[model samples]
Target: MEIERSDRPPSRVNWLLRRVMRYFAAPRLNMREDYEKVRRVQRQLAVLPGPRFHALDVEIISADGDHPIPVRVFHPREQRRDEVLLFYHGGGWVTGDIESYTPACATMADLTGCVVASVDYRLAPEHPYPAGLEDCLRVARLLLADPTRAGIEATGEIVLVGDSAGGNLAAVVSQQLRDEGVAGAKRQILLYPVTHWDHDPATSEFASVRNHGDDYRLTNTEVQDYFDLYVPDAAQRKLPTVAPLMATDLTHQPDTLLITAELDLLCDEGEAYGAALERAGNRVRVHRVNGALHGFITLPRFSRSLREAYDVINEFLDERVPGKDAEDAT
Candidate 1:
């Protein structure tokens, strides 16, 4: 039953992936050519074998904001369900968009039987700090206020889901909704999320950073680079709006499913956040999938680990959430 090494060594697929990633590694990050390398990488990956899940791409002008926020809605066959998920695509707060994450979103929609609305939030460096988060929060609030206007049924509930940098956005959004007394967000699913920013070079602590930091695709330094670009102000890093891990009050935050890859650099922070949420008395479940690497959710076609991750999420949803797979209104 236990094939993966608990010590978190690189799997055969990831070993090959490391080679491919290094091959496509970019020159450096700057404003002008920042997305080029990732673009190349995504192009290469697009050709790779992966699940083909299609969805209806819709454009909506936010009621609170003027930007044309593009959202991809994954509708199950026959009819649509009332529940919805606001998914944020992960690209280190810099490179990801809804298109890159469409396949995964559509798959999740099918699995969960809830319409998945993956938001095309503005990326960082070009947009920076609060810009992308603002887009997500606006989407949550606007959708909750008038779901029908956006073509989403009024389910009177929302689940926030994201991975990596997008997971950070999901956490902060949940915190804000809780703080503002917005009652719609009932659960949050954060996959290998970035929860804290203790940027002290001297501190090579934390079980994950000291252990699995090197072999993983998301290195500690790269994580720091993303944090720096997202929040240039060091003091602002302490703000709950930016980092939910630093939030003083974790009280009554949404019921959570925090999934962390055992080999990920962010594993400790994600687990710690789950602990803090438990301390705050919120129902939380955290899982560290064995031998999995970061961004596994986007690699369904390549990894069986992705299926395991889905199994955990589906178990959580069907067990905890009401209207689990309730028949679509014909």
Candidate 2:
């Protein structure tokens, strides 16, 4: 199958920004020193002043009975939906925290008019694979069990939303919840998620890895570095938890709204995962944001790609049928 393409190209501003990123930001990470550097840089880039929203910080005990996970809850100025969004921030499973993502989460709560709970899961290298994943799962279960615990007056479905590695966690958590025979997330929204384990052009099948991996903000080498840090064991990398696309069973997943960035290395695999879900008879809508890069959601609200993404997200939350405007938009 052909990967979807957009008729429109990147805007002049986006083009210039991509050039700058490629020059300065798109380098393979050094697991030792770069972790802190990346965290600092992400804060600089993502922690901008955003629209005001009520926020609260709370702690949820981990299922392992070991420690408490920090969760930040954001309430929009006007609550328009009863559903709450359980969000997982993306940092290749390593470098992001709730504090670094506050601005983005606040914007999402305001834009979607839904209460947003941002989970601060453990990172890799120090915590590794199951550690972060477990923290996310524990938080999700607690919220699903009782939204009021997080200060949400939710009466509707609890939607799982995440970007990049967080998207990976959400997909796995949804499946695990189904396996447990519990009424878990009924809907999910994934933004440029990391679905597959491999990005090597020599071995991987996705053409996007070969085409856009090196030029955009997220590079194949950088992704490989993240995996090495997150899952040290290569054999475990193929597991369904680590790579959702590798799962043989895709049945009974939540209704999915999958958004991929046109210029991202993970684009094709994300779309492919959506196709697999559709084949398994799940409600799936795949939207490719034209001329957008991975992590575009954290860009300033005025960004064209960011605006288009929110439009798609709000439409999905509202259950509005997609209209034809862009190539393979929905």
**Please, what is the TM-score per model?**
0.83, 0.90
**lDDT (Cα atoms) of all candidates against the true structure:** 0.74, 0.86
- Per-residue lDDT tens digits for candidate 1, residues 153-242, read 655467789999889999999888878888657788999888887633358446787665545566665666677778888789878777
lDDT assessment of candidate 2: 0.86
Q: Write the per-residue lDDT of candidate 2 for residues 1-330, one digit (tens) a residue.
A: 224444576434467776777775457466445888879887786555556668999998888788999999998888898889999999899888898888889889888889899999999889999999999889888888988877777797789999999999999899888888887787899999999998998889999999888777889878988999999999999999999999899998888999999888898999999999998988898988888989998877788888888888898898833442251243
Stretches of model 2 off by over 4 angstroms after superposition: 1-21, 28-32, 44-48, 320-330
Off by over 4 Å in 1: 1-33, 47-54, 62-64, 77-82, 154-156, 199-201, 321-330
Measured by TM-score, how close is model 1 to the native structure?
0.83
How many residue pairs clash in each candidate at the backbone level?
0, 0
Relative to the true structure, candidate 2 has a C-alpha RMSD (angstroms) of 5.1
Number of the top candidate by lDDT?
2
